[model samples]
Target: MCSHIFNERNRSFSGREVIMINTDAEGIVVDRPNRFLCIVNITKPVTMESEMVHVHDPGRLEDILYPGNRVLLKRAAEGKRKTKWDLIAGDIMGEWVLVNSSWHRKISEWVIQNKIIPFLNGIDTVIPEKKFGDSRLDFLLMEKEKSIWVEVKGCTLARGSVALFPDAPTIRGRRHLEELIKARNEGHEAVVLILVFRQEAESFSANKVIDPDFALTFSKAIDAGVKVFPLCFSYEENTIHFRSLLPVFQKS
Candidate 1:
């Protein structure tokens, strides 16, 4: 098992320890044809012209995917691929926010493996995408005989200093919350781990205005003993790393 421990002695040029990430190149958004593809002007390949890139995030990122917005892209591995670049992160309000949903699972897995998240430490085994009921959960952590079901969500929508999830309405997200509640009721530890891809967030809340059903379901999940953990992180250029955990408002 690979474990990462934060060292105060090691620091980067910005006075923060360099957090390793998976992105390779930088680009400026030219246009987003749809949710899956975006046209960007590459900065690393010396490409003065705009090129179409793949966007893995399914959410409607109106706030971050604006024209001229700085974006981080991962170059596709040498082979036949749909697009040469994959849009992963974006600069919003001067901070780099992770826009890719694919990283949500990996980041949460890293935290769990490193035992960085409070109350979820000492995991003996970590399993990804485990089946529980009708849905596939993000992780199933085993510690001795005790098991925990974890669902991870990437939060990119922020209003001022407050971070919110599901910028758009998501019936799927609400269903996941219901499953978490079910797992909790069956004598297993259930958790919804929210990864806020911003640094300035003071607290975490469900976007009730956008999806009232999700908000209500989230509250019900909490009432049924489902734990919700929201943690903040920041990225600059190519490095991405954890910052700290934020206060969770299940009712908000």
Candidate 2:
């Protein structure tokens, strides 16, 4: 078994640290810097003495920033882009920070290789285009030779045993469910994977009051044979581990 100990002030880790456990131990890392815009996880807010500015990186802003995200920062160093600050190394800062462009790619790569790949053998899956049908579906998997269209929803919202999806209402999410339902009718399996970042939620459900249309679409999809799987995992300082699969709670 591998373990990771955080050295917060130095912004580094101990030796042979397990960046991601359980899921894909081989692909996770610690202390590596990535360049991508990230939203601060406002669910776990951090305080800063100085004000930080948000800038646009035209290339990948859409993939990085979310409404309630907070970002990590490094003092402007010599020879770096004037608008950018170095992102912090770990996920547990006082505030949830958006990873910048460079960091975003690293996180995405880590998730795909470490988190997503190891789970593939258990199911037949395909790598769909990042952006599809006005919404990006993470992986299109086929189980029992049946196609399963999945939209990977990353969950950062957690309050003890409760886990919430899309802290803000998502129009794209509604569309994704609609698409999944259509795929189910076409004789394929359609599903959603709520990838919970923290090991807090024991069950998952759509934030219906937050977005009724999403709730309606989710109901229709499940009724039409679209499966919803909520997975929770733990990230100890730097490493990530798969906990247990949680059942999805459908809202009436």
Candidate 3:
């Protein structure tokens, strides 16, 4: 009966816990001055020509943030802010992807609460930003006395049907992988959940070409009993929802 409920929720496309966004405007990317800001030409709410927007993602989005590429922005909710728009997602290679890293935690939490993943089933409690050793993991789920530390990574860069993480070199990400391995060694379950923000990706891998150090660390972490779960999601209009689980392409 519980299994049926979980499967039904996954099948619904939009999960019951989905964050609703009533208003999202389409735009064209004009320029991104830095990691935190972008200039986009709004095409909705009277097509106000050009407006500066807040980019919630800090990673270098070279593949997606090209000039003239279509983007989706949510209007700042009646709040006094420097920018009236927040860049949420953008189109790449004919597919829309959620680029806002800030939403990663919420999406992960929704997945856990809805029991969308098989391994995460039967979780009795979900704690966010749990400190383990010298690192703060994204989530610490408990089932009775057993605990599982999970680190979530948002992957927006892909080549062909393969998705990759840390489009830029990330020393911080490598350290988290090391700590997850340590947790596994100490008799607790450890997992790295890759949120592949793409539509057609069939598999995922650590970006060895961009960050070889992270790639090597990921390999070691998996060998030390750390599990990897890569799930693909699609962005349509104003909604971003999980589509299906993806296989991890092991590096040879």
Q: Which prediction has the highest lDDT against the true structure? A: 3
Q: Candidate 3, which segments miss by more than 4 Å at Cα?
A: 1-18, 78-80
Which is better, 2 or 3, measured by lDDT?
A: 3
Model 1 ranges with Cα > 4 A deviation: 1-19, 22-24, 250-252
Compare the candidates by TM-score and give the number of the best one: 3
- CA lDDT, every model vs. true structure: 0.79, 0.49, 0.82
lDDT of 2: 0.49
Show the lowest summed lDDT stretch of 10 residues, model 3: 1-10
Q: Of the pair 1 and 3, which is ahead by TM-score? A: 3
**Model 1 C-alpha lDDT per residue in residues 1-252, reported as the tens digit of each score:** 322222112222222333466777778999998999899998865665578888888788989888899888887777888788788888887778888876677678777876666567778888998999988988999988889999999898988888998888998888889888989889999888888887888678888989998988987887798877777778865666777767765443
Please, what are the lDDT tens digits per residue for candidate 3 over residues 1-252?
111111112233433325644446888999999888999998875687769999987689998888999888888868778999889888887777888888888888887887777778989999999999999999999988899999999999988988988899999899999999999999999988888887777778889999999999988987898888787888765666677777777656
Better of 1 and 2 by TM-score: 1
RMSD to the hidden true structure, all candidates: 6.4, 11.8, 5.5
Give me the displacement of residue 242 in model 1, in angstroms. 1.1
- Runs in model 2 deviating more than 4 A are 1-83, 86-125, 130-136, 142-145
What TM-score would each prediction reach against the true structure?
Answer: 0.88, 0.58, 0.89
